[model samples]
Target: MPIGMILWRWDYRSGAEELGKYPKELDVSDKTMMQLYSQHLYGAQSDIVSMYVGALNIISVWTGSTHNYFLSLLLTIEEQPEDYKEVISDLLYYLIPFIEEDTFNTLLPSIYQRCTEFPSTNLEQRRAMMYGSNLNRAIFKTLSEEGCFYRDELKIWLEDILKTKLYNFEYIIDGLVQNDILKTSIVRGVDGTYVFLLKYLICFRAPPLDLSQKIKIAKDNELNQKILKKIRDFFKKYVPNEQDNIEIAGYIRQTNYWVIIDFLRKSYAKHSSLTKLKLHGVDQVMNLVNNLINSDIVDIVVDQNEEQVYFLKSDIILDFVPMNYMINQIYNMHVEDRKPDKLLLSYISILKENYLESH
Candidate 1:
């Protein structure tokens, strides 16, 4: 079937009549397309459509719901289990790209509970427990609140709920710490109680400082020393001497390698084009590339590249590059000229295709 025809049929059945109101050839953002598709799928009377809609609703929630669409859809699906398998498939497909392993495990159990009412069927029960187990493990690995609570505290929390022992609690905590989701810190309280701070293990967000301000802040607060000490201590405590540099280098390489390659490729492509005169200067390109490379969303790559440069590979790159530039350009352009610029739009499209294809 033609993709458009299928979409249209689905839309009509799902009550997304407004989607049909748009001109047939009019282009829309992916977000708009998904929203319209969801509204249509959700509104349909068919069991299949309802199932698909339920899955899409779960995707919306995991990706940080901007609305209550998922909650409404969940309510709708709770009344029907026969319609759930199709919805589960759709949810798996749509949400696969948007979630991390940990987050999916954490959230899927709750989703299963709502979908199947603690399903007693062997297959259904297995799937529900698997999702819940995975999610809980992931959450325990990543979130400080889940990891730092002492064995006694953990036992109290799990008591009748989990029927697990103190040994099991320690095992889970150790596993999470090994996975880099929980970090240990020596926290000195105001009352002089020195406790080990177990907190979410995450990379630091970039300091909100411009060039001059960054320099001043670093100098005034002796931030460099503190940062160095933290790094030194973390490595000394958690990393064996033989593994310390290798581990840190791996992180840097994963994050920066892709941005460097892309910058080089774009530069080469632009230099060969007739539009070279209109392109940003080398310095400007370098600055933007540096900023993107250093951004928190990127994973740094450090190994020897066959192409000989650093790069970043993250889903955020798809949204970040164009959205960052497009908003500023749109502000300066007239409404009639507010369409996404050609290069930025092309880049976003390519990134999206690559992203979708990967998963």
Candidate 2:
């Protein structure tokens, strides 16, 4: 029942580099993993296959150095001469399971972008429902008999989407509130408004405004001292008062360390000559330097008389953190929990053996 071979075959697609040359002798014509998995697993075989393949594509698109295979496929799928509707729906369904929590966080932006392209009323609603359901499942990690978002569920949903790009604060607030994604009067509350602004700052990493500037904006209208206090508290929580070695993984998870790493990686990829990257806030930058060094994701170099700098360690494998975390989770489930998912364990094993052995 274990589909170890599928994971083994799919391992080659997981890297950040361009796809490697496929073996000439291997055959994939008669059965595209769909036929094979159909025989072994429950549920629609085609659905599972599409989800797995689409996940590989998502991983590639998210991490690819130069090209986006997902977008390219989207153009092709959209223009399909026949069966376009079914293909799009199935693709959307399969994609939900594979979405990386840290990368997309919330599925709204991803789903919304695609829905806007199709413009079908029914399709839009179906996709919205699918996205909302999947998001709820992801947040709760289990389905409730009654399908509805409770107050706490709505709060988590808000926080997740808050991390995504918000072009207009007022419009988003009104829309979400009106749609019952948030409490009707939540936005008007001091704590609620403050939380929103703090999230915006963290999410965007916008250029810091001085205390007077921030307070001026806060006090200029209805927003006031409570807003400023929230911002100050966020700085306190994220920024350290004194120098200390941070617990790397824990700190990264708490403060979205992946975002910082992604930013640095993109900068390095853009300018090959750039040897160092500078970041702001928290104890001449607490946690990042030590975290990067500990993760082996970057090389730390100190200037003779100045600040420390970080260089991306090119040989270090991409997808290390998430992939390793996944592998560990599977191992724990199998050995520690007295329950085993042989298929998933096989996938993790093949992935690690093929690409992560060095790590």
Candidate 3:
């Protein structure tokens, strides 16, 4: 089920300047901020209720503002009993969904900092922020199933979160696109289905590093071997016979290897490099490594037996965590209502399987 009405609280001081700068005078009294917060909180809740009344759906309550006065108190919600009790009471009495402790912990600081940059004047901008806000919630919900999102899925997700059209959504998309942090393209499926693509421009950063440069960096980094091996294993297990050696190698060369390695270690430490080899067999492992080297994703210096080797150049590992997290969230949203597009699901499923296997 979708999260119930969520209540988020922030300090009023963090955004005091913006609030002061608001063209219209905001009801700034202590009671006024509380009332405004409660109003928005309840409004969101009511909207959810109207949409799913009498259904077995959850209602989440989130509270907080980007005010400085509330900062210390907000920080205490998770660890301080009195603060926690107060927030809990506020939520419980409203029959709202209780924010998970970890989630609350994750969100508090972010909201606090974000409120400081409150450009509340533009309605479109505010709506865009709200849309992005939901993405964070979605990420928390989806961390396990997929590891990347196709562009079309992102467009749909933005629509749902913003409750608006693509034309209106351009405000946010433009920023991401201009930053080179996001890319939109047309992708052709094996079945002849064509779709728009939204993906992180990990390899398209400023002063773009060419494929060979990336591969050289990867070779120089010792971690590429482990990452390449993981990628190969992932494909072998879930996407057998579908390996795009060039594409996979290129991705690795463009990616940030150390970061990927760190994330892999954190998420799947039990299946470390050594453990994977023992389970998958030595020859299979060797062949995969050889493929990566042959693809020029890595430069390898091998011993006489051609067994023991080291990478001489390689690319930095691009961060795919956000993509992965987005995929998981979409998966969960699909599970709740089964509304995610099939093509999107298929693409992400492929990504998830490969990522999980590689890790």
Candidate 4:
């Protein structure tokens, strides 16, 4: 018998809840492929087809729709050529890449450059960004009504909304700060914490800058920053036709990750009641997920139910979609009364079998 052959149910097993929350796999290879693909980094003589396939695979995962569904999406994107610049503003998290060490420290500057460019693309993403997170709404509401907020002051307010004590709440604040959704103003003789004051936010921003004026500034800054980015990129990666190649890759990798990461963040945050960049750090996460395709060799055999199992000497199979996400998905489908997914059942059994000496 084969795994995923029958309609296996999760509720029938012990530790059913744990099994449902088991992490999906994020293969190391896949992770690297995604990062490199995002930056338009590829082999010296890489063919376009390999690149396209990876992009298609990424888009599929990002959309929660199938990878095969990208032909029309890609076509639509291509038809609107300016579409590449379209940034999803309320992206739940933006990866803040922290390089191990460097003389020039090009990575951080590159990210800053990326930041100034996003608003330039259009306000469509801003509209999307405005309403995506509960934290965003709470912050907006507090700032709207109170006209200014202190960090500690805001947390007490949120605790009331959530009906539970929030841990690591600083991470939520950190994410907002890093993403530029929030900025800080230090009080004169107060505790010396530079919290984002609402008046400071609206004062300089609202009166002097009209939307079109802001867009023009962003667009000009984007062009200048783009040049700096390309110069840095060309010097570091230095390949012929790199910019054109990156343009192609950006369509699938860089821009859409904005879309996909937002989607994934929203999905996970919904059930977990957390925001981005807390569970996730800047590229330090490498854990096992159940559904990832692995190159590891382990036992392969059929169980009594005629389902196949994967066993390793050390523990169960490991892949990397970050386990908590799987839990979120299970809760979602369960509440919606959808048919059970076969692969999900397979994942459950595989995860369940992980602790057994032999199955």
Clashes of each: 24, 0, 52, 11
Name the regions of candidate 2 deviating beyond 4 angstroms. Answer: 1-232, 235-321, 341-345, 353-359
Q: What lDDT tens digits, residue by residue, belong to model 4 across residues 68-116?
A: 1010111121122123222211110222111112222233234333433
Q: Model 1, residue 275: displacement in angstroms?
A: 15
Best candidate per lDDT, number? 3
The runs of at least 3 residues in candidate 3 whose Cα sits more than 4 Å from the true structure, single-residue gaps closed, are: 1-156, 159-301, 304-309, 312-359
TM-score of each: 0.20, 0.21, 0.21, 0.25
lDDT of each: 0.32, 0.31, 0.35, 0.31
lDDT of 2 at 105: 27
Q: Residue 118 lDDT in model 1?
A: 27
Please give the RMSD to the true structure for each candidate, in Å.
24.2, 22.0, 19.0, 29.7
Alpha carbon deviation, residue 72, candidate 3 (Å): 9.1
Model 1 TM-score is 0.20
Error of 3 at 83 (Å): 31
Among the numbered candidates, top TM-score falls to 4
Task: Kindly list the per-residue Cα lDDT of model 1 for residues 1-359, writing each as its tens digit.
Answer: 01111111123344322212111453333444455446434654311233334223221121112211221123232344344443343343333423323244355444443344322233322322322343333343322222123334444565445554322343344443554333333222222211121222222222222322333444324433333333334334442231332232233332233333334332212222312322432334444445544642222222222222222222111101112233343334434553234423343344345346545
lDDT of 3 by residue, 242-353 (tens): 1342244333322123223223332222223523643432334445445545644344343334444334223322232335546656667677754446646565655555
lDDT for model 2 comes to: 0.31
